[model samples]
Target: MPRKLSRLTLKEQADKALREMISSYRFFPGKWINVERLAKDLGVSRTPVWQAMMDLEKEGLVEHIPKQGIRMAEMTLQMACDLYTVRGLLEGLAGRFAAENISKKTVARLESILKEQQQIVKDQDVVEYSISDFRFHGLIYDFCGNWLLKELLENIKTRSRPFVCDITPIMSGLYQDHVEAVDALKNRDPAKAERVMRRHNLRMRRRIEWTLTREERE
Candidate 1:
């Protein structure tokens, strides 16, 4: 017999479904999401779906219009840069803390994520690789033991979801940065880990800007 799956509450289920939809570009930036249709598709009531949208809104990913419904927020280049700037600082601290605090098991987890990421990139599977990318950074935040830091990072990451594809051109370099971060963490060099993490995010900002510039040129 198969193991029983754990049940999620209506709101939790709704939120997870909605988040995946948004992340996969099912709900594109600046597009209005139909509350009733989403609720019906998710097989949940409007109340829970509405609650989920509100939660995403607080993360700066969605906005509630007075009578039009929920719209996914557009990530302007400035907004992307600002978010990445703060993410660099916060994740730098998180990396420092992780260097001091990450367990051997956590190190193994990070390694596994990187291994998967390598294969994903080799296959040029951006969608699968993006999920691994999220997990890689998320581990550091989770192990950092700073509640506020984790909260802020989570919010910014969610807010940046729509723009993630913008950095695809430099995905290989991004993975290399993750590799260096893991090395720093393994060595437990707090300063090195912090610096590498900051530089990693800074590079992401630069890559996004480059991508935008090329897009404008085209």
Candidate 2:
């Protein structure tokens, strides 16, 4: 039993480490994954790595092709459109629900996160900024009062990670969007908050679309 548990632990560790690599863009979209090479990279046996890839496949983060073995999920144009559409609707609903009943303390905490976000943006820490950005929206989701919607949004965010060329160029705009979102929430204007959040997502989708269209040229 101890030996079996140890193997389970290694598989879970490999799964978590692979997820980190995916988040950091080390294993990018559409890239073929070599099981043996990945085992070496994660410092684990091929069995655990293969098992981890199987788990990721279930999560839609990676897929097993008949001839290609395993590959990271690619964000196709249709997938992008569907994801951002659902994302916009759900995020807008979350903002509306949060504005309806969020506490003052929670709003204050969100403002604090924004301040930290400002510093991270100015410091050009893209990764840190991304983390805080998600936190800001996630906090709103926590107050959304709809567990199923929140769960759907979280799943979509993971399964539909977009392809961005450079994040540094968009940090300021994103910060401004957060400011407007929090401002609406501060005033308890549900309609305005929903509109602002939806617009923010629309703009992001447009940006990704442009990048996708221009990828071949670059």
Candidate 3:
């Protein structure tokens, strides 16, 4: 049992290390990550490393090769387009719901989060800005009065973190988009809020595509 527990600990560490690598793009998109090297770096046996790689593969963050080892998953333009379409539909629904069902108190909470995001932007603190940006969206989803929608969005955001982190340098435009979205929500204009939210998501999707294209060409 103790031996089994030790193996579990190794797998857990490997999983966490792989997640950090993916988030940091250390295993950059399309680059094959040698499992042996990874095991050596993590000071673990290949069994734990392989287990972690399988988990990441299931999450769509890694791709396993028949003989070559694992590679970081690349985000294609088409995938981004599809993801944005779904995001727009679901988030637009959330925005419309918030406009109808949200309380003034919730709006005030969103306002506070937006203000915090603005400060993070002004300070050029990219990490904090990204965190606060997610918090702002979360506030809206929570007020949307639908647990299922909220959970769906949360799962999507987890899958989206890599893309979001890649586009962190464009925070200024994102900040403006957030401000407009919140303004529309404050006015209780569901139509306008949904429109703005969709546009904002579409714009970010486009930017991510542009980045991916440029990287591919390079």
Candidate 4:
């Protein structure tokens, strides 16, 4: 006989379904959430669905208004700037920590990912390449020796995906940054590794700032 699958409570089921819908862009950012409709769609009661939205609200994936109701979190130009700033700071620290924990195996895995990223570029798949791009940075955080940092970065990526794709260009120049970061780790240079990672994210931040500035002008 097959093993019995663990059963989820109604609230847990609703929570899982809600997260999937949000991540898949089923609900666009800032769109007002219809709890009754969502409950019906998920085959759950409105109470469980409402509880789930409250949980997502704490994760910064949704918002609750005073009288209007709930909505998906919006990524304003300023918010984009702030997210990249945190990404740079945390990922830069991941670089430093990873350098301290560097090993031949880590270098090998990073190099392997870089080769895959190259193939993604050659194949001209922007979406696939974007995923590989995140994988490259995420691998560093995995080896950064801080579980909390890794969890935080992963959460940020999950929430930032739609916004990042819309606002940031995935350039060949970013691929070069990955190469340099791995090389720094191979050379066992903590400062340089951190610097390269920070620079990589700062480039994106600069672009966000430029857009924000231009919008203010317009």
Error of 2 at 85 (Å): 1.4
lDDT of 3: 0.77
CA lDDT of every candidate: 0.83, 0.80, 0.77, 0.78
RMSD (CA, Å), candidate 2 to true, equals 4.1
The digit string of per-residue lDDT tens for model 3 on 59-105 reads 78779888676887777778777777788888888898888888888
Best by TM-score: 1
For residues 133-197, write the lDDT of model 1, one tens digit per residue.
Answer: 88898899999989999988887777778775555677888899899999999999999999999
Worst 10 residues of 4 by lDDT: 1-10
Better of 3 and 4 by lDDT: 4
**All candidates: TM-score:** 0.88, 0.82, 0.72, 0.76
lDDT string, candidate 4, 83-189, tens digits: 88898888888899999997899799889999998887677776667667777877898899999999988777667654634333546767788899999998888
Ranking of all candidate structures by their lDDT, best first: 1, 2, 4, 3
Task: Tell me the deviation in Å of residue 192 in model 1.
Answer: 1.1
lDDT of 4 at 148: 97
Q: Tell me, what's the RMSD of every candidate?
A: 3.5, 4.1, 5.0, 4.4
